[model samples]
Structure formats: C-alpha cells, structure tokens
Target: MDHVRNANPFTSQSSYSRGSVLAWRIVTPVSWLILVITSIYYSATKPHEGKYSRHTIWGQNSHRHTPFALNSVIASLYWIALYILQVPYLSSLFKEDNTLPLTLASHFTAHNLLTFGFIHLWCRSYFWWALLLVIINWFNLTFAYFRYPKTPRVTHVAIIAGPLAWAFVSLYWDGAAAVHSHHTAARIVANVFLWTWLVYGAFYIVAFKDWAMGFALSILAAALGVGQFFTAIIALQWIFAFTIMAVLFVASLPVAAPGVFGGDVFKRGEVVSEDRERAPLLAEP
Candidate 1:
C-alpha cells in the first residue's frame, strides 16, 4: 500500500516501511497495533505537549480530568434527539400508510451539523483524531484491495495511495471532482472511513492475538454492534456511527493511575544541587 510520511514534521523519519509497501493490503491485527500503542501512550503519559494533546479535551492533572466528557455529552444528545424524533419507531407509528417520520429530517440535520462541525474543528487543531479517521478509512480500502485473489502489489499500493492522493488533491491542487460536493459525498466518505476501521479492527483482533487484545477488541466491537442495531432501526447510519465514535472517543480518555502518573516523578519538589561550585572545582582539580 502507498505509504504517507508520518504526519509529525518533527519526526526524524517516517513510521511507514518502504520495503513492504503492500503490507497495508492485508487486514492483519498489526494494523490496529499502531493506534493501540498511540492511544495507550497518550493515556499513560498524559503528555501536555503535542498536536494530538492540544485537541484533546482532557490533559494532565491541571487541565480537564475527563477528556471524553464533551464527546459523551454530544453523543447522548444525538441519540436523545433521534428518540424524540421517533425515527426508530416509524414503522409502528405509521403502520398502514408506511410514511416516513418527520423526525428523520431532524435527525439528519442534527447528524450533519455535529459531524461537519466536529471535522472542521478537529482539522483546525491538527489533532491525531482527524488523522486517525483517515487511517481508519485507509484500513477499509486495504480490506477491499485484498479481497481479490492474487491482488497485485501495485494495486495494493494504489489502494493505500488513494486517500493520500485525494487529500493532496483536495487540499493543494483543488481537483474539481473531489470538491464541489453538497456535503453529502463528504459525509458518506467520512462514515465509510470510520465504520471500515471499526469492522476491520474487529476482524484483526480475531485473526491474531490472545485474551487481553481479544477483550479490548470485543469491547470496541460491541460498541459498534450496538450502534449498528440502532442504525438499522432508525435508518440513521450517520447518527449511529457518530454516537459510537463519540463513546469510543470518550472511553479513550488518558488517565494516569497511582505509580503510573508522570507527576510522581516530581513529588517532593525539584531537586537542587548544593555543591555545584565545589563539584566544578573538584572536577578541574
């Protein structure tokens, strides 16, 4: 698969492997490893600095304690709005006529507003969340790429390259086809990117790993699975996806437990050297 350089410009080298360009073609468990590591490290270290941290609602001790709170609230609002709209209970509401509920329109409006606004905000922060979205979408493309028998390595590369190419075209070159959308295409693309990641992520867990990884994967899968049921009932896939994304996003808040907190390193206060001059003199002597 075509590899994009690591998004962090400060990195000395890119994280992608040049030799195994087609490595992303297969939906191996390892594909999720990068995200798992990134999420865990962010949680454990609670680093105050970095692009990802900036967009995060929560941070180390001083900042917000619950990073995922905003996401959770938003997700809950979306679901509640759908329920009030009665989109899910449409069949029962209009048994004989089978007319669609007015609530469906409201649900769609709210879903688009939330998603578009979130993406715009996330992009401004240059947070890893946006990049993660892209990566998840690419993972889906990879699955499609490998579905064929004897898939050519170049084909795999093309699949990986597609998004990068689109990103470039959208951002820099201003390709007309990529743009000029009424936001429908953009919404669909974003959903595909997200759901693909969740689906492949589930498959990856089953294909490789033990209990711990399996358990984590199961939780993630369960979230999506529950979300899917709601979508089927309400015909609100975007809303369902957005709600699940919010829950997953909130659940990933970074928290340092006991000895794990970075603050412990500075518990007593900053250590000071009392004999700095004497040490220098002794060294010279």
Candidate 2:
C-alpha cells in the first residue's frame, strides 16, 4: 500500500499519479534533446549564410553574428554552471565520506554565487532579483537538509521550481531581441531549454515524483548553452558544446533515474525513505 504524506498546499496524496511520473521521465530528457538539437542546428547553419539579415520569429533582423566578446562572457558563465552542476554528481562519488556532500555543496554554491554575480552583476537589471530568488531556492534545500521530516510538501515544490523558473524567466528575456549572433542565439536557446524544466517543474509544483531528472537536466542544458557562447566560429564552439553536453546528459541520465545524487533529491528524498507510515511486518514473532 502507498504511504501518503501530509497535505501540500496545491495537492493531496490523490494528486500523485504514476502516469505523471512516467510522463516526466519520458518528457524531461527528450525536451532537452530536442532543444539541444535545434540549438546546434541554428548555431551551425544560420551563421554561415552570407547575409546581414535573417528574419526571426519575432520578425527582427536576428542573424548578425555578433562579436566574440559577448559570447566569450556568456560562454564562461556556462562553464561555471556546468562545474557547479557536476558537484552534486561528484558528491555521489564521495558517498563513502559522509560530510563531503556538505563541503562540496557549500564550495560550489559559493562559487556559483561569485561566478553568477560576476557575470550578471554588471547587467542593467536582474542581479538582485536573481540573487534573491537563488537564496530562496537554497533556503528550501537548506531546510530540507536540516529538517527533512518536518519540511512540508510545498517547500519541495519550491525546491523543484525555483531555479527553473528563474532561468526560464531570464532566458525569456533573452529573446527580447533576436538571435543574430552566436551569443544571442545561445541565450535564446538556453531560455527555451529552461522553459521545458519550468513546465516539468510545474508538475512537481503541484505534486509529482522524480523531480531529480527535471532539475538536473534543465540546469545542465542551460549551462551547456551558456558554455557554448563564444567569439570563435559558431560551428566549432557549438560542436564542442554539443559534444560535451551529450556526454554529460548521458552520464547524468542514470544518476537522475536512480536518484544517485549525493545531496537531498527533491528536498524530501525518495518515497520509501521519506514516508512516515509503516504497517506491521507480518507480525513475524
């Protein structure tokens, strides 16, 4: 029998469904696959046409390959993001050492803050907003870390949605212009990839399972797109990014599927570990 937990604001135990879990399992990675392919195609083909003009979906001349500086900056951020995302998986490698996850998580999250600040702090806007939301995201996880049994279901929703929503909103703003250069196009694709996670996060926001895959995949995808941005030939950098991400994606797939991530998976951990109820063990006397 299923051991249903306490009520969340948006859903009850009845909200849990195997169909939803399976849908997410199938949809989460597939969405990233589609986005990555489209991004790679755009980065490869569109930059070659000898034209100062390319009509975008928003009807802007969105095909001018901008200078390398913009992409270089964006690309650096992506690398940093990838590094940060890797920490969790690596923590699993350190599972024999119990405290390693905390040490690694702190180190990387700090690195993320510094790197993230350096990248976007100088921007015209969105710094405070980004940092604040990130703190909230971290708060959810921190709470789950220290107080799993007491942490409510709604908090898990926050953990699931926080980063995806922030990245999604930020990326949506990316398309405020057009995808002229490798940088612009990269940002746009990052937005769309993140948008997929936001949709997946929505399922968890109400009530669902296996949030690890959606969360990890979305972060890695956005990081890949960010890392891809560069002043070099679009094709070269895109291929590099795609190759690196393809490997990362495949490697992470099993990790997410099994919840092998060292840290708290989805704030509440998995079902069996978290459920508070247990029936009599056949009264084996």
Candidate 3:
C-alpha cells in the first residue's frame, strides 16, 4: 500500500512497527504542545527578576542595533502564523492514507524539543547555547524538507520554508547579539552577510521552484528594512533591505513559466475538462 511505502522509506512493502507508529503519533503532538505551553509561559513572564529575559536581550541588542534585527511585531506574527499552519500540516501527515516517514516524524518531535531548549537558553542570555540548538534544529528541518516531497501545501509554508527562513535570518541576528558586535565594521559585515538571503532565495526558486521560500525571505527582508528605517532613517541598510525584498517578491510571482514560476500546483490548471470528468470514474466501483 502507498501508506506503508511512504511511512517506511526503506521499501515499498516495508512499514514501521505498530509500536513505533504509535509512539510517533503520541510523542509528536505532545512535544509540540509542550513547546506551545512553554513559549506562552516565557512570553507572559518575560523580564523575570534577576534573569536576562528575552525582552531584555532584545532591548540590549536594539541598543547596539545590528542590520539583521527584524521588527519584533512582524516576527511575532510570523511565529503565530507558522504555529497555526503547522497544526493542519501535522494532522495531515497522520491521515489513514498518508502516514508520515519515520525521519519526518522524528524531526517533528526533536525539532520542537530543541526549539524549546533554545528559547529557554536564549531567555537566560545563554546566547551560544541557544545558537547551537537553533543550528541543530535548522539542519534537521532543512534535511527533512528536501528529502521528502513538498505536498499537502502547508509543509512548504510551515514545516520547512517558514521556519527555515526565520532560522537562517536568526543566525545573523543572534550571532550579532552573541558577540555584542555593534561597531561600524560589524555593521558593514552584517550588510554583506545579508546578501546570502538573496542568493539563497534565487537558487531555491530556480532549482526547486520554491516560491514559498522566496515569499518567506521577502517578508523577513521587508521586516528587517522596516526595523532599520526606524533605527537609522538615513542609512543604506534599509535601502538594501527594501531592494532585496522587491527583487525577491517580483521574482517569486507565480507566472506562466515552468518550474521557475508556478509549480506543479499551478500547472495543474492546464488539465482539461475531460480529465476532470474521468477522475471520478476512475474511483468508481
């Protein structure tokens, strides 16, 4: 069965053990729920006495403002949206006919747990440890993303593209905070590092036809530009951010071009009415 084939990538007929599948079903959701609770608790109780809370860290970073720091409000919205979208996508993976691959199932559980750890460390000013957890989580998500098919729609946006874009951007932001590097030379270095997003967005769009990634990167760039505009109204950083955002947004449009524009989902529009009529019959008894 296709379900068995997909659930265990080892072979078409191979399937994960009942106990293994049961554990994934239970542990994955539990891990995510734990993360959600802890995130809320931290956000609500931030600036805790005697601790360098998340807000404190951000405020310190803002005082020494790096080019990579994004608008906190926009970042919050992105996280909220990503968390909501992940629910539907995660549910789909466990559908009767769509069992998730073992690796992906493991990733869902481990990534959430690691992210929780990152938040805990980050709030306490353990910048180096937080960065390590984020890097590990990013690697797991990226590898699992490309290894599997981009289907069920939400996977592209929530599971990999959205989180991955944020994580990639966070590396620069968090690294700047970690080193407390806020000098002119450090700012110049940060500006140079920003181009990696453009390069990354373009390559994925061209090679993987990954419009979701392009869109995510565009939004992050726009947020960065907005934050920089307020931080230093006369600087070139905002200009660069807006320019990168515009280019990425325009290029990500779902045009008629094959692969480079609209992916298979859009191309499916080319299917004739005859095929639509035949699809129902193919399922008939």
- State every prediction's TM-score relative to the real structure: 0.23, 0.28, 0.81
Tens digit of per-residue lDDT, candidate 1, span 187-260? 35544444553443334323321112223323333433453343344534435445544543333221112134
The C-alpha lDDT values of all candidates are 0.30, 0.36, 0.70
lDDT of 3 by residue, 1-285 (tens): 645644554332125566766777788788888988887776655546535545543454464477777786776677788889889756754665334334466777787898888777766777788889889988987887766543445655677778788778878777777887767887788778788889988877776667677888899999899888998898878888899999888877762244765465434222222223112211223
| CA displacement after TM-score superposition, residue 10 of candidate 2 (Å) | 19
Give the lDDT of residue 237 in candidate 1: 42
**How displaced is residue 265 in candidate 1, in Å?**
45
**Candidate 2: residue 232 Cα off by (Å):** 5.9
What is the clash count for each candidate, in the order shown?
Answer: 2, 2, 0
Candidate 2 residue pairs in backbone clash: 62-180, 68-231
lDDT of 2 by residue, 1-285 (tens): 232321221233234355433443344334334433443343334332322443321122122332211233343344335434443433332233222222223322443343344223213223344345445545544343333322222222222233333343333333332233345576455434534434444443224343443444344444444533543345444444444345445543443454565544433343233232222112323
By the lDDT metric, which is better: model 1 or model 3?
A: 3
User: Which 10-residue window in model 3 sums to the lowest lDDT?
Assistant: 275-284
Please report, as a residue range, the 10-residue window in candidate 2 with the lowest summed lDDT: 55-64
**Candidate 3 Cα lDDT to native:** 0.70
TM-score: model 3 vs. ground truth: 0.81
What is the Cα-based TM-score of model 2?
0.28
